[model samples]
Target chain A: MFAFYTIYKGYFRTALIVQFQYRVAMLIWLLGGIIEPLMYLVVWRTVSEQQGGSVGGFDTNDFVVYFIAVMLVSHATFTWIMWEYIYRIRMGLFSVMLLKPIHPIHSDIADNIGYKFLTLTVMAPVTLLLAWFFDASWRPAPWTLAAFVPVLILAFLMRFYWEWSLAMVAFWTMRIDAMNQAYIVVGLFFSGRLAPLSLFPEIVQRAADILPFRWMLSFPVELLLGRITPRELLIGIGAQLFWLLAGYLFMQLIYRAGIKRYAAFGA
Target chain B: MYYFRLFATYVRVGILGELEYRANFWINIIQSALDLCVALGGIAVVFSHTDTLGGWRQEELLALIGVYFLIGGLIRTLIRPSMIQFMEDVRQGTLDFKLTKPADSQVLVSIQRIEIWRLVDVLISLPVLGIAFLRLGASLGPIESAVFAVTLLSGALIIYSFWLMLSTCAFWFVKVENIQVIFMSMWPAGRWPVNIYPTWLRAVLTFLVPVAFATTVPASAVSGRITGATLIGTVALAAAMLLVSRWFWRVGIRFYSGASA
Candidate 1:
């Protein structure tokens, strides 16, 4: 454990400096993240107003707060490992990664955390600015705020593990774009990125409850919005814990098999 | 006519090169199909909540999405790939080879690379527009068709010029690829009508990026929602932008010193 901690520290420091050098690229990517949710916020807000200030139990202010929460939570939990892995494998960069004593995922996790740390400096202020601009009004209870920390962390882990596992598909075939797009389209609807889960049709709502995507993103946002009950919170956290473990185990299985195939190629 | 033949040759070469990879055609079809699903799904979800969004009906919005993909296909197929190649050339000094050629460097750079598979987006958009038109029961008169054709052409030229100006900035800045990302990041906003955005964002989409002209204005023209003033403004902006971008490209070329130099 102590050795792992030291390794993480070194990786984090390197990642921080490397990411800082490409801060402009990072900020430009963040612009996409910010704009998508903001567009949804505006769209739903328009829908709510046109329907006389409320649609499906969400007022315009509720839509504003909901989507703002979405922007933050989605940003927090998102991972680019799948795409990065494709690039690495295609460029033969993974050969070097495999030579390292440590697992490659550790560096990716460290890099992700380092990037989020640097960008949060910008994201925090932008969040506040958007809140004020959109007239966001959501007052979570103290308990809700306290629970959000652990839930958010679990969401991040669940997303990272699942995406990292999905990245292993690159080992089998380099043509992962279609698979990635399908994943995104599914997540867009199921994770409540397109709209609130509550606003979805009954069948979609059921599917979301069964899928892990909701637990990764929309659950944390919903919890923070004070829209979730204590019972629902307990159930949701249980689902998150389940998916987190599942994703981790699946990642381990895929990595071992993928590494075997990768090594066979003599790369 | 000489330039046209050169363009055709570049396109023919691109097509022949891509034809070597036959599986990529299927992959492109799948990607385009998924993209269409996402666009149509977003409209479906939004219309589920209300009858209209920002005064756009479901079918009209579908038409807008169709145009979004159509323009997006054109960019990916020609403008984006060529400009990205240009940036890479500038960075690696490979641009020296193109500059040494007797042809106009701008024309050569602009039509140099094509991802023919990306044209799948253009083909897929037709069915979407057809469905939208069928649902709207809209008949296009000669004038309406003429206006749309003009606006669409103007929109494409405006976008091509905008991309040229953007890519030309790499002459001074070595790592301006991120600038391309900024354009792409803003591109999706055009998937919807710009008027729904707050005033400031609307302005940015209009003037700074001009994605509105590329998407919403053309859609509006076809839908019979465009005003005369907006039509004239789009054409004027396209003409002005083309001239400015041409001048900017010349200036950028003057500033570019090869990496070996």
Candidate 2:
């Protein structure tokens, strides 16, 4: 455990320095992340206006809060591992990664968290500015606010593990863009990034619950906004735990199998 | 006339080069289809909540989306790929070879690379536009079609110029590739009616990135929603931008020192 801790410290430090050096590149990437939710917020707000200031159960203010919460939560949990793995395999970088004594997943997790820690300084202010600009209003219970911390941590880990597992597809085929895109499209609908899952059709909402995407992204956002009921919160957390464990085991299984099949093509 | 022939030669070469990778055609189709789904699905979700979005009927927004892909495909197929290549060349100090060529460097760089498979987006957009026109029952008179053709030409020019200017910054900044992400992020805003956005954002989409000219103004022309002033303004802007970007390219070329030297 102590050795693992030291290894993570080194990895995290390297990630922080590397990412900070590329902070300009990092901020430019954030433009897309920020705009997606902002565009949806504006569109939905426009819809609510044309519908006489409310659509379904969400008022304009509620829509604003919901999407702002989405921005924060998505920034917290999103991963680029699926794409990174393909690039790594193609460049033969995975060979070096495999030679390391530690599991490659630990370095990825450390890198992701390090980058997020740096970007959160920018994202937090931007989110607050957006909320203020839009005049967002939401009142979560103190308990839900407290619960958000643990739920968010679980959401991040679950999403990371699942995406890491999805990245394992790189071992089987280098043509992973289509597969990654398909997963993204499915997740966009089910994870409530495109819109609130509640706003989706009943069938879609049901499917979202059955899929892991909801548990990965939207569940925490909903909880933070006081949108989820107490009973639903219990169920949501339970599902997150289930997906988290499943993702870890699936990632382990795939990594072991993929390493066996892996060949150092460019190396 | 010489430049036009040169452009044709580049197009032919680009097409033949891409034909080597035939399987990418299917992959392109799948990616385009998925992108279309996301766009159309977003429209479906929005319209599911309300009949009209900021006075844009479902079919009108569909038309807007059709233009989005049509223009977006053109960029990806020609302008974006070429500019991205230009940037990579700058980073690797390989741009010196292109500069030493006899032709105008800007023209050469702008038309050099093409991913022809991205035309799948263009093909997908045609059926979408047809369906939108069919549902709206809008017959295109000669005037409207002429206006559309003109505006479409101008929009493409404007976008090409914008990309050239953006890419030219690579002469000074070695890592300006990510700057393209800024335009890409703003590009999707065109998937919606620009007027529906807040005033400041609309200004940014119009005067700043000029994505409004690329997608919205042309869609407006076809939909019969365009004012005469917007039409005149768009053409004027396109002409002005071409000159400005040309001047900027010259300036950038002069500043560029070959790294190999």
Candidate 3:
């Protein structure tokens, strides 16, 4: 445990320095991130107004709150490591990473957190601007707000593990574009980026519930929006825990296999 | 005319290169099919709740989506991938070889790399377009068809110019790849009718991104809903942007060559 802490701290310090060096580039990337959810917010708001000011139990204000919550949850949980891993492998950077004494996942975890911290400056302002422009407002219940922290942490870890596992496919195959596209398309539906899972068909919603994607994004957003009932919240937490364990185990298996393959093939 | 032959030769090379790996073709097909499905699914989800989105009927929106795919495919086939490669060359200082060639630098940079796989987008768009036309059940007059074709060409020109201008910024800014992400994020908004967005967004799409002319204006011409003003405006914008991008490219080339010397 002490060794792990020391490794994490070292990684974090390195990441902080790296991120600070490219803060401007990080800010530009944050602009891209902010625009996607904002675009959806505008589209759904337009739809709601056209539909007599409500759809799927969300009023205009409710939609505002839901999307704002979505913005934060998505920002917190999202990982770009899939693309990073692919690029690193293609460039032979991963080979050097594998030679390090520490596990590569720790550096990635540190990088992700450091990036989020540095980019939050941009995100906060953009969120504020969107809220101001769109007149978005929400009131979270005290308990729900309390629940959001742990749920958000679990969601982040679950997503990080799953995407990291998926990125390992790059070790075995250079043609990961198709797999990445498929993963993103599925994620758009199941992770509630396209719409709330509640608005999807029953089959889709059920699938989303069973999949890890919902726990990665929508569950925490719904929790913060005060939409989930107490029973549902408990169930959501349970699902997140199960998926987190599953993702960790899957990552371990895939990492071992991918490393063995890489060693054999000399990537 | 000479450039067209060069482009054809590049395409031949690209096809030859890709033909060596047959599995890539299947992978490309699956990726493009999934993209088409996601687009159609979004349309289905939206139209489920309403018959019209911003006064665009389902068929009209479908036509817009077809135009979106067609134009998007064309951009990816030539403009986007080439500009991406050009930007990388600029960053890596490999553009010097192209500068030494007898051909125009702009033409060479614009036609350097071809995916060849994006033909799947072109192939998929035709059936989607035919179904939309069938669903509309309206006979297209010759004049309207001619106008649609003209506007479509103009729209393509405008998008190419816009992308060129964006990519030209790499001469000054090495990290212009982020702009591609921003462009794509805004592109989903164009999948729906531009009229559905608010006035500010509509203005942005029309003037700022030029996405309105790329998909919506051509789609409107196809649906027989285009105003005379919009048609003329699109043509004019396309011509102006083309000139501007050419000038910008010249300046960027001069700067790049100067810096290298």
Candidate 4:
């Protein structure tokens, strides 16, 4: 544990400096992230306004707040391991990571955290400006705010581990872009990125509940929005915990299998 | 004829190169289907709540989605993949090989690399477009069809010039690949009518990114939402942009040689 901590520390420090060096690229990435939720915000806001100030119980201001919260939460839980793995495998860069004594995920996790740390500085101001622009009116109870932290962390872990396992598909097929894209499309809908869960069709919402995506993104946003009841919050957290463990185990299984394949064929 | 022959040669070469990777063919189909789903799903949800969004009826919006996939297919089929290769060539200083080629460097770079399977998006979108038209119970009169063809041509020209201009920036700016990526990042906005966006955002989508012309204008022509003035403006813009990008390409080539000189 001590050695792992030290390795992560070194990785975090180095990745932070590298991330800062490519600050312009980071800004472009940040722009893409901001645009998604902002697009939904506009669409739903239009819907709400056209429907006489409310659609599916969310007024224009409610939508503004919901989407803004979603932007932050989605940003917090976002994982790029899919693209990262695909590129690394294609470029033969993963061999370096494979040879390292430690598991590669630690460095990826460290890099992801480092990136979020840098971008959150910009995200805060962007969110504030958006809230101001759209007249956001959302105030969670103090308890809701307190509960949000653990839920967000759980969501992040669940997303990272599952996606990291998905990334391991590159070991079997160097071109997993199609698989990755399908996963992304699923997440885009099921995770409430396109719209809030309440607004979706009944069957679709039921599928989202069964899938892990809702637990990863929408649950935290709903929790913070005070839209989730206590029973639902308990159930969501339980589902998140379940997925988190499942993803971790899946990652371990895939890692072992992938590494065997890698050693047999060589990266 | 020369350019067409060159493009044909490149297409044959690209197909031969990818023949071993049959998995790519199936993967591309899945990816294209997934793209259509997200687009259609978003429209489904939006229309479920309201009859019209920004005066675009349900079928019209569905047609917009079809056009989105169609244009996105054209982009991926040639422009994006080639530009990516061009960007990498610039980064690795391998663009010299293209510069030395006797053919026009612009045409050579644009057709050098092709992902033949990405054209599935256009194929898939045809049925979607047909269904949308059927649902609307609208037949495209010959004039409207002509206008659509012209607008789509203009749209394609505009995007080609826009992308080429952006790619040319790599001549001076080594890190302009991410700048190229910014186009795709903003592309989802074109999945809907740009009129739904706020004024400033609408302007950005229209003037800055040209998403309006690239996807919506062509669809609008088909849906009869396009006025004569907009069609003229689009053609005029496409022509101007094509010339400007060609001029900029020459300037960049000169700048590239001068710097090394």
Q: A104-188 in candidate 3: lDDT tens per residue?
A: 9989998899888887877788778778877877677999989999999999999999999999998888888899989989988
Candidate 2 residues A1-267, lDDT tens each? 999999999999999999999888898898888888899999999999889999878889988988898888889899999999999998999999989988899999999999999999899899888877888877889999998999999999999999999999999998888889999998999999888888899999999999999887888888887888889999999999999999999999998999999999797
Stretches of candidate 2 exceeding 4 Å from the true structure: none
All candidates: TM-score: 0.97, 0.97, 0.94, 0.94
Candidate 4: misplaced stretches above 4 Å?
A1-7, A89-101, A264-267, B258-261
TM-score rank, highest first?
1, 2, 4, 3
Q: Which residue window of length 10 is worst by lDDT in model 1 chain A?
A: A258-267
Q: Which regions of candidate 1 are displaced past 4 Å?
A: A264-267
Tens-digit lDDT track for model 2 on B1-261?
Answer: 999999889889988998998888999999999999999999999999999888888998988899899999999999999999999999999999999999999989998998889999999999998898788675566787788888988999999999999999999987789878899988988999998888888899998999999998988887788899999999999999999999999999999998777
RMSD to the true structure for each prediction, in A, is: 1.5, 1.5, 2.2, 2.2
Q: Look at candidate 1 and give me any clashing residue pairs.
A: none
Docking quality band of candidate 3, CAPRI definitions: medium
- DockQ score for model 1, please? 0.82
lDDT (Cα, tens digit) per residue for candidate 1, span B1-261: 999999999999999999998799998999889888878888888899899999999988998998999999999999999999999999999999999998999999999999998999999888887887777675555676688889999999999999999899999987788888999999988999998999989999999999999999988887788999999999999999999999999999999889867
Which structure is stronger by DockQ: 2 or 3?
2
Q: Judging by DockQ, tell me the better candidate of 1 and 4.
A: 1
Per-residue alpha-carbon lDDT of model 4 for B68-146, expressed as tens digits? 8888899998999999899888888888878888999988998898888888999988998888777766656777779
Give the Å error, residue B235, model 3: 0.6
Better of 1 and 3 by lDDT: 1
lDDT for B65 (candidate 2):
91
